[model samples]
Target: MIKITYKMKSYRENLKDIIQPDDTIIELGCHVGKSSQFMLNRIPNGNLIALDNSPEAKSKMDKLSFEYKNLSFLNSDVRLHESLKKVKEKIDKCDILSVDLGGGYHPDTTFKVYYIWSSTFKPRDSIIRNRGLIDFINTATSNEDMHSENGFLDSCGDMGIPPQIKEFKLWSEKI
Candidate 1:
């Protein structure tokens, strides 16, 4: 799986460059079928398994499945064991794993999904679009900087910190 350590502007922003014509893809959090269609167009012979928990997303995907024979939709949540088990029964393996849950807002959830799915499929490559994770990597500093007199708030950059969070120590201490 490919690990991206920098900030990406959009979800799976660089996927077009990596996807091959015959690469099987499993896309988690396919909101509608925009990205799914793009991937289908790329892989004429390959297959795509698009998974989403939303009823709205499922309705759209159900329609798309009719139009594309190679496309399949699974209404399942990546975070749930039962849901994932159902999804696993449908697909054995894939060449690429693409994930963009919650529009890539929650890094923790994104990491969890990536961990579970990567372990299940063991894809040749993976692309995860999470702003929080990218920002965390971009803003990380050295241990010496973290131990500065000003502390974590002053030492680390502020790219990923949400406005709702007032204090880093308080948030970190919670969990």
Candidate 2:
């Protein structure tokens, strides 16, 4: 298992650039609140909604919540459409949607969950695990005809993501 310190270091080095002070952030798969805590430190005036299905994850975040008043934990399976809908209704808009569902989830399921949760918010930056899903989405959304034979690109194309969505990398390196 990857230690939480490594995850926190990865976020600090690679993903910290995208976050702003007052941005409303929603993190999917807050395992042990490690990543959430990293994001919390940056968002002083901002609020975070951390979601995870594991009871242990919830318990860990519950303990950390006392230290950070702006952080909130929601114990729910982010892959579920109902849970995504409920979360979308609660937040007016999300500035950043950080997704790290861990290695248990297949890349396709991760992309599907990201797509579902992303639709609720208007054009915002996102940091996703560099599990080929980001590369696939970037290639699919761009007009450049690269990686045509890639399986992930084919899958995103099948999902009907238009070529108009802007493509950018939020993290410099994979965590």
Candidate 3:
């Protein structure tokens, strides 16, 4: 077993709490498979669909694929609607969904992809990076802020998903 740092150790433990042995998981922005490896360790009989736009990340994931039979890597831009749609088609549903697109910018593209893809499966549990979560909640809740925030939220509103937000502390430590 790999020894994770304290922060990651707690995050992994939180994930393990929500993830079942046979639950399917879809992770967006799976850079070099750090989280993927942790998730793979938990789901022995389940499946993991990891997506990333970086060729280097894909290369690393490709190597890890040989070691993990339950993992599948999709080398594509998660911000693209077409790419997300394609993934949604492949795995109709999953028990857990994790999003960590990094950069802390492009909330529009990030939430757009997340909203669209999440609508397909509607996983019971979703873990999003703090910035993404804040952006999503802010846009979803207040209409006035929606106009000023970004066009993606307006677009999401047009799709008709109600603004029902719930907050929770899933992990004790920040990653």
Candidate 4:
């Protein structure tokens, strides 16, 4: 099965740059730890906590955790503030917080109504949505292009998402 997720680009503030070896990294929707591995490289001595509430996802995380001594897995929902707060205490400030809420979205929201789910095309068989959420502070609009065959880009970016977030991107100045 193909997935349609928020796309994230590595930047200055990204885990690879900002997170020191001693710094702890927190990532949401870690899934199978695809990008998690990238962040791990930046922190040699640090521990990475991948947050995902799904049992299958968590089990996947468990499998990955054994490989990396510096890696830890957590099975908890995003809305579970109690658990998240506990994590926050250990890691005071986040050098990078990956907001990737892709898996387990119940297929689609109101936006999916407009999305073409099924047709002469075979949906995921025909197309795959590769998106990674990025940081867009104090913004009301952003621009992005949909897939080649698909130009209809209904981005959540407009609802306060970043245009492009990659390779050491940073915004210390208050919006």
Candidate 5:
């Protein structure tokens, strides 16, 4: 259900802002290991926990881990707290937690990056975001998805104003 679009550049920079040698990463939907691979290469001293419900995730990560020394893969569904418990034991307060799998694309493909991140990371330490439309296009295609950029900015605009997307225009002027 998870679709992978590797927006390697933005993703890498985003990770760089927060990822440190001491930090660990937990990607909710590893989907063919695109983000996993990107983030893996970035943090050589740190470790990445890649999780996915798809059968391919295990095999792909197994192959990928061979190249990256600090990577591990787990076959787990982020939706199920029970499934997440063991992974939680290994990685909580992950430096980066991305919800890139869920959407109309995948029904149960980690629809709650916010909730999981809220529970997993300290409020001050957490830097979590969802990879819905913008992230997906940016990740899947080899080019920058301008639509996603606008969408993300538009979303932030909504966050700024009447607290509704309809009021997004109001925030644009404030910015």
Candidate 6:
């Protein structure tokens, strides 16, 4: 399951569909450990490696780490290649990858980050929440009448295709 959305109403909504009990998860941008804690609660036999650059976020997650043996916090910026290498060295496998960079208002950066991390870990499942991505889709598909009749698009539903879908499909296969 790969979910790319404007925003998740709640991160926990579809967690069961993406994770298993013994799955190893790598979560990027786990701010204050709210969703981190939620994922931790769901994975008792598994482990969660959460990365965030914010010291305050790490401070909070440190407390959760103390309480949940399966949870570990890494203080590293996800946008840096060095950080990716650091994470790669620590984990042998990543079963699921969850990313929510907060204030995701830049589609190019979001897509680049998502692509790098997804390609690196090659997680079986990935969930990314970025408003800019949805905005980009809307703008690119506007002239094609891709918007819904209600004038709103739901990322989870069938929101029509972008002009580049044909080329994207072909390019994706090479990977």
Q: Over 4 Å off in model 2, which ranges?
A: 1-9, 103-105, 130-175
Per-residue lDDT, model 1, residue 95, is 83
Q: lDDT tens string, model 2, 50-79?
A: 999987897799988889999888888886
Each model's lDDT comes to: 0.69, 0.65, 0.65, 0.46, 0.54, 0.71
Tell me how many clashing residue pairs each candidate has.
0, 0, 0, 16, 5, 0
Identify the leading candidate in terms of lDDT. Answer: 6
Q: On residues 60-139, what C-alpha lDDT tens digit does candidate 1 reach at each position? A: 89999999999988887766666556666777677888887755555977866665566566677777777788788788
- Please rank every candidate by lDDT, starting with the best: 6, 1, 3, 2, 5, 4
Is 2 or 6 the stronger prediction by lDDT? 6
lDDT of 6 at 76: 82
In Å, residue 103's CA in model 2 sits off its true spot by 4.3
Give TM per candidate: 0.73, 0.69, 0.68, 0.50, 0.58, 0.75
Ranking by TM-score: 6, 1, 2, 3, 5, 4
Decide which is better by TM-score, 5 or 6: 6
Taking the tens digit of each residue's C-alpha lDDT, what string does model 3 give over 1-175?
1111124455566677777789898988889999899899889999999999886797899988999999989998865545656666777677777777763645665555556556555666766553544655566754453232321233444343333321111111111
Clashing pairs in 2: none
Which sections of candidate 6 miss by over 4 Å? 139-175
Under the 3 Å rule for N, CA and C atoms, how many clashes does model 4 have? 16
* lDDT (Cα, tens digit) per residue for candidate 5, span 1-175: 1222335565455556655665577776677887787777677787887778888788888898898878877787655555556665675456556555633343222334434333444322333333455455466755544432211222223332232323112212222
Where model 1 places Cα greater than 4 Å from the true spot, the runs are 1-13, 142-175
The lDDT of model 1 is: 0.69
Query: What lDDT is reached at residue 26 by model 4?
Result: 62
lDDT score, candidate 3, position 98: 74
**Cα-lDDT of candidate 2:** 0.65
Which candidate's TM-score is highest?
Answer: 6
